[model samples]
Target: MNLPATDRRVLVSGASRGLGRAVAQAFAANGDRVAVHYGSRASDARLTLESLAGEGHVLVGGDVSDPAGAARVADEAGQALGGIDVLVNNAAVNDPHPLATTSYEEWAEQWQRHMSVNLLGTALLSHRAARSMIDRGTGGRIVNVGSRGAFRGEPDYPAYGATKAAVHALGQSLAVSLAPYGIGVASVAPGFIETERVAHRLVGEEGEAIRAQSPFGRVASAQEVAEAVLWLASPAAEWSSGTVLDLNGASYLRT
Candidate 1:
């Protein structure tokens, strides 16, 4: 089964680093035109764009949480790539807060940030992308990079978990609402991804514990998660919509 996404125009948020960067690279490798979005790091976004194997990879910068910024991304992506065929909302903010020690201010901040970028921003951009697809009169794909925390609560990050749960719901809602227009929406949720940001949180014994919890006996690589993202947006997954695909190595099963 060859997974070729050639000629597809994909907009990937938070592509300056981590899982977003990996996914952007994956799409570029598959010969898709990619618009790589970065929130704050222009240098990093440039680096990611330069590293792509394809010629059409472009860097876009914005705080997607802002409605104007989200719309701008859609416009730039559409213009640069000749209109977006795929939208991957992979931007997120994660800061741990245990309930007992969590402050009200901190909780509010987390919720606001998470909802702004992870939920609202994603929704707005998806809307814009869908409109473009509708105008083209051909079905398109929208893939939300969600977290396993959506299904199972994270003891230290209630706000983050709740927002991710909302992401799942948002994808489902968009799926149903856009079905008539030939647009599909789905989410890919992964657990304990191995990235530089998570390295400090999981090391030595703790890392071992996390590995033991997963059926694969290890945390997932960014490439692994990116592969799943590619699949969800690829023609291979055309029949899948409103689906929450779990790529967690069966670490936390939903019942």
Candidate 2:
């Protein structure tokens, strides 16, 4: 990616590993100061901070599922970064629970957890960061990490898909509301990604079927998604706000 025109203070949530870690590294490489936030992975977050290219990166641990906790985490990051110019909402949890086999209790728990972490967590974090940027009188950006399941639907993980859909909708709403404040909002919807967390599924018997979902015959990589987030948060792409960029390698087309 091209270097940013100016140094930015960036806060990346769920940056302990995978895509979040990559996003943090990209920002650091762009000469941006970063606050890496993780829900319950201090060691992994430390590794991300250590892997960052530049100095002045801090690791923050907090449970974003709680509104107060999310605010606290955002406050700490904003202070450490001397005010944030970018916020990447990437923290989420996905657990499989198909309706055919799931009890009502299990379904209820899944929805609650999914909404808490995926939608509420992101909205609360963005609210805090946006408020900070408004007070600072500096235009900033908020990029949400969304998923293709939001558009295509998920039979086994309905809660995951529903929350992602909400995330995208939330981005568009914020884009309109925060436009005057100069805080652009957007999201990236990606298909199956090649990550350690899902390595077993990718290499399983259904591996070929998964790859065949895309015309490229392969899933996307963490770095690819990170690159997209990096660009969306850049000034040049401010006009792209409210857009949900599809990074699924042509796997699922939305009309």
Which window of ten consecutive residues has the lowest lDDT sum in model 2? 1-10
Model 2 ranges off by over 4 Å? 1-4
lDDT per residue for candidate 2 within 159-207, as digits (tens), equals 9999999999999999999999888999999899888788888876689
Error of 2 at 217 (Å): 0.9
Clash tally, candidates in order = 0, 0
Cα lDDT of model 1 by residue, 13-114, tens digit: 989888999999999888898999998988988988998887877888887889899999889889988888889999888888786887889877877887
My TM-score estimates for the predictions, one after another, are: 0.95, 0.97
Candidate 1, superposed: residue stretches over 4 Å from native: 1-4
Model 1: ten consecutive residues of lowest lDDT: 1-10
Cα lDDT computed for each candidate against the true fold: 0.87, 0.92
